[model samples]
Target: MALIHCPSCAKRISDKAPFCPHCQFARTDDPESLERAARIRQIKHNQSLMTHSFIALFAFVGGFALWWWGGEAADGWRAPAGIGLMSAGFVGYLITRVRIVLAKRSKG
Candidate 1:
């Protein structure tokens, strides 16, 4: 069988194959299918970004709140706990930002 390129992923596949082995793109030559595949990928990427963003937001807010509440405590443990929470939140946010930048670079 002759090999053909899978438009969805630009991978080579046997012309007789029912679907692309790598990306699972169907063998159809329809333009809409390719567009649909791209759209699906984009939607998934957006969902991931949203999830990260929410997590980052929650972490930052929670950490700040903890720190604020802990500052009012007479015991020393609360201050340390608050600092740890804030540090964790900062780290999480940094990681998320890095991932976002990397993703954008890869996409470009």
Candidate 2:
């Protein structure tokens, strides 16, 4: 069997190992391993961003639509709703941006 690094125990374990013999870390080794682990982490992070982006896009669309409808709906309450939706989109964007910045900083 080939040798591989254990991210958990920081030990070199056998590629076929079900668990690290020295540190007892399980499912931490396998064939087709290193690339798979990196792909999994990247997919998870992308899913998180996509979810936020979807919500933000919906909010932005809703805000614009409401702003247009406000003129048609008497009393202009739709304008307020539109403003709220736009604000929500802005807040979501800011949160996402901050998270990205924090993640970058943490890497260094």
Candidate 3:
């Protein structure tokens, strides 16, 4: 087997080894393996963004429903609570949008 430098730990390792002995980083010089790893990372990032968007939508809708329904109730706190929930949802959406933009910028 030939010796090569580990990409993660920068240590010498056997080219045939599946992982680095020092840092346990997966060793794959194949173009397909590199592409697959990049794809997986992208998929995971997209999934996270989707989750954040869903949560934001749910919170905003739930808050609006609460505000509408709470109007019939005599509680003075209901309106404020609903507004707070909606604001939180708005903040989450803004955060998600910023993160997506930053990711695209970094990629470019």
The true-structure Cα RMSD of candidate 3 reads 6.1
Q: What is the lDDT of residue 102 in candidate 1?
A: 80
Stretches of model 3 off by over 4 angstroms after superposition = 1-26, 70-74
Provide backbone clash counts, one per model: 0, 0, 0
Per-candidate TM vs. native? 0.60, 0.55, 0.66
lDDT of 3 by residue, 1-108 (tens): 899876665679998999989977797778776666666666678779879988997898877777779356425787888888888988888888788788778767
State how far residue 106 of model 2 sits from its true place (Å). 5.4
Give candidate 2 misplaced runs (Cα > 4 Å): 1-26, 31-35, 70-74, 101-108
Q: Please identify which of the two predictions, 1 or 2, would achieve the higher lDDT against the true structure.
A: 1
lDDT of 2 by residue, 1-108 (tens): 799876445578888988778756566435566556555655566568768877887897788777777456424677688888988987887787677667557646
Which candidate, 1 or 3, would have the higher TM-score against the true structure? Answer: 3
lDDT of 1 by residue, 16-106 (tens): 9999899887777688887787677766776797688778777777767876774564346666776777777778878887887887788
Better-scoring candidate (TM-score), 1 or 2 = 1
From the highest lDDT down, the ranking of the candidates is 3, 1, 2
User: lDDT for model 1, on a 0 to 1 scale?
Assistant: 0.75
